[model samples]
Target chain A: MTSHIDTCGLSCPQPVLLFLTALRKTEAKEFDVLVDNEVSRENVTRAAENHGCHVTAHQEGNDVTRLHIAKN
Target chain B: MKSLRNIFVSPAGIILTGAIIGLLAILLQHYGNPGNMGICVVCFNRDIAGGIGLHRASVVQYLRPEIMGMLLGAFVAALFFGDFRARGGSSPITRFLLGVIASIGALVFLGCPWRAILRLAGGDGNALFGFAGIFVGVGIGTLFFRQGFSLGRNTTQHRASGFVMPLIMLALVLLYLLYPPIAGQEKNGVLFYSLKGPGAAHAPFLLSIGIGLLVGFLAQRSRFCTMGAIRDVILFRHWHLALGLAAMLLAALVANVALGSFKPGFEGQPIAHTQSLWNFLGMVTAGLAFALAGGCPGRQIFMAGEGDNDAAVFILGLIVGAALSHNFDMASSPAGIAANGAVAAIGGLVICLLIGITNIRRGA
Candidate 1:
């Protein structure tokens, strides 16, 4: 039910980009993305919805966060 | 429920707040923005570049802390709010190239999207033509996007990749603080600041930086982008982006009126020219390049602050292009476009179109 993408060290367009690619590869009902920054979180979240996915996000530490995106 | 909460509560709030902040920027500039400009992403960047000794356009050189503050403020906000992430490697070189071209286009036209609006608000009839050109350019880019045009996807990289831009901005701020511009000196520090001219004109450092930070924080939250607004409407008939753009124009108009900075004719506009065709062509070139590159100059700067190395490269490209513009006589003056400006604009359009067409997958 869950899939993961490690985007810890990517930049603006790429993190969102990799998330999109990961979305294409997974049919998991829920997806969790591990990112190292807030901008990527926003970008990924936006990209997810643009492709019809819903996202929920939570911060874990100074340099890490988890984004939960569900395929709608 | 959380997604909607974040969307409606955060991003929407950010958009509205950002518009208000933009209004404040106009007001601040009207009262005194160090010069005639209230907010100019490109010109300010050029000033920062000049302060660092990148080029010598004496009348328009200063180490603008607002530029540094934009990146740093965004950095702090992202860090504070748990948003700072550093990831890159998606067509960085291409992004840098696009940035350079975009800057050249902007300089040729003599301003970025924000300046275009400011010019219009100040009663510069020339900006009307420039806005029209921007639409045409964006329309072409939309055609390309529809054709499946893409610069290529980026892959994940190291955290250090993301920190590069912020560090550079920090260094610029340090230089500005340590080596304040001296009157009648060729070498002030790494760069030169004009004792007078447009370079000398600037809002107070702290005030400018404060405004920059406020704008950065709000814009980061809002996802407000000028190009995105036009692109969204063209692609999806969405008005969310359009609303923000309208808000900016409206805010500037009202603020300019209140400040008595609203001039009503094309003649004698500040830092602008009246060559209608070039104005249109210049922005057309700028608009296409911005669309292809993926954001407006301001948006790109905010993105760079949030660890977008590609966007950082684009920002650098703009800085370099600004230097190149003055060095090579490619930039426009209030008098008009330089001799080769039109040719360069046409060349840019051709190159962009070529890239757009070649990269598109025919049946994707």
Candidate 2:
């Protein structure tokens, strides 16, 4: 199963909080996170790794980025 | 919505709005608030602290409805705009400790980031040193941020947890309204009003409250923060936040001129000190703490209102820190820092540096 988290238009801790919420709801092997900036994507990806996940990132535009994290 | 968005959505727009807010504060001061201080988050909070019997600074005690109103106003606006959501459990303790340190640093210099600007507008030359200190502090914090330093992560909790800070603000408003201080007995009620000094001077209750609400609402929407402005410039070389900050300074400068309040000197400034070294050190500590904590005092208040419980805790820590500053004689005066303030300031910087360096991953 795959779960998705959207952290667009949020700032600082909000994106982190939203990612945490989505992570708690997922028991899936894969997670898709959408963020609107590089900083948020980096933070999210770092957080995922801290929680024992592997991340692959893709940038769509100046303000859009996606991260796919695989859970062990 | 369009007009409001125009005033607050862009970086320049938000800075202009912040400047207007600063100017309004000046006009408000001209009409009533003492010492040309129209809006001061730390001084007002200290006054509020006195009003609630948290301290006994007679000349600085007031049941400032504006402070309470800022939070409540923001709370209402956030709810109406679909922005309210309570969450916390992040390194709440750490954030709170940072708040305490931030407030102590501000009091040691006798003002928060906003008051530092307002003091300068009023011709307090001392603020120039404070401004420099803030830059140095932000520079240090930026280094830590670049190294991947974070206080910790926040976890979601029950919605009621978010309302605690707003509810406390509501309670303050109620205290102000019901326990109207008796004439000549300003300290008799559950709320106190200043009889003299900066605490006595204030914009009309309703006017101050209204402005507080407006600023709170707009700031929440735009994510405006003075520290963030400086930090963005130092860290990512971003100008979005810097534009807002520059706007605030320019607007305030213009407003002071129009109001005949611009003095352009370091001496005879209200609620300010002339010890150049401490002014620089004081703001450096505050700036660094704000950088680590991630917002200015005003921004922290607005964040607290928007259901960020960790922010609220930080604010509470500030209040307590103010009380402690006074009780321990660590706060500064117009004359300057107390006898031992210099030593404390240096100690603070060293401690902050230690925290910054140690918290980063060794290689990262």
Candidate 3:
């Protein structure tokens, strides 16, 4: 099952850190993160890629972005 | 609604916002702010520190309204936009120490990242060295980031916790009004004032705060950050933030020319020094510290405004660091770098590198 982490309304480094925290705590290979701003989206993507994960992101609503991060 | 948000948050939107801020900065200078220093976070923080008697640098003492305005502006924007969430606990001590080091580095160079760009825009040749130093410093930080440097995680807190920094800003505003600067007076029972020098020079209080609030509101909305601009470009090849930075530079340069304040040279440029080597090393320390801390000084204030306690601690560190800089003679002057400023700059760089190395989450 894919883990879901909602990080909407949080700022940068927070979103990125949440993603990292989720990565650390889980043995699961996939995570779905919801971010609200472009800075958070880009930072989370960079962080996921840095940790050897593939990130596929898509726009959700007007201000929300959802990213599917899978471990490589 | 979507289109309106886009107009405020899109790439073009950010560029326009940057241009506006740049032009306003030069305008602030043209009015009465120190030359080429319309809005320097570090310098202003230093002055604020002195104003509060954290240091005894009489010539640089004043309760700067711009700092309070930025924080209050960001606070209001965060609340209106529903982004204020109280969170911290991610190595607060480490972050605070990094803030100190960052302020020291900035002082040695005599400007933060924004001021360095503004200096260049105003045609100060010495800023070139500072600019090059920031690039190299951020480059080093990128290496740590690639190696998994992390400051850990921050959990959610009580909503009231988020209001602390904003409340402090409001308190400062109250203090400024309660003890307004009296002419020819250095101190008025409480709070210090500079009778002369950069601290004494300022645009009208209302005008300064107004521009500051507007900049903060737009910056919060756009997530405008000087350190992030270079970091994104270096690490991810992203140009979004870089566009904003370039726009600020271009706009500031044009404004300087139009205002007839554009004087390009290495010597006698306002409150800047001619020590090229120290200037480079100074920003190298600042850039590294800023990169490791996750934001520049301005960004930290904005984050604090939005309820990040860790960023708030960093801002406090900057306040204390400014005190230490002047007390220990580690800050530079137009005359040149202090005797111990260069040593402290090197020490700051080493300390930041150590923090970067120690904070890496191995195998995670």
Candidate of highest DockQ = 3
Q: lDDT tens digits, residues B139-250, model 2?
A: 8887776565666545556778879998898888777778866667776656767787777777777887877887777677666678877876665455665676666677
| lDDT value for model 1 | 0.74
| Lowest-sum lDDT 10-residue window in model 1 chain B | B1-10
Clashing pairs in 3: none
How do the residues B1-364 of candidate 3 rate in per-residue lDDT, one tens digit apiece? 4465557767887898789889999989988999898899999999999999999988899888888999889888887876677878888999999999999999999999989989999999999999999999988998887777878766666889889999998888889889989999998768999999999999888998998898888888788889988987887676777888899999999999998899999999989999999999999999999988888899899889888899999999999998999999999999999989989999999999999999887533
- Predicted model with the maximum TM-score: 3
Ranking by lDDT: 3, 1, 2
Alpha carbon lDDT at B252, candidate 3: 98
Better of 1 and 3 by lDDT: 3
- lDDT against the true structure, each candidate: 0.74, 0.74, 0.87
The TM-scores, one per candidate, come to: 0.83, 0.83, 0.89
Superior by TM-score: candidate 1 or candidate 3:
3
For model 3, the DockQ equals: 0.19
User: Clashes in candidate 3: how many?
Assistant: 0
Model 1 / residue B108 / CA error / Å: 1.6
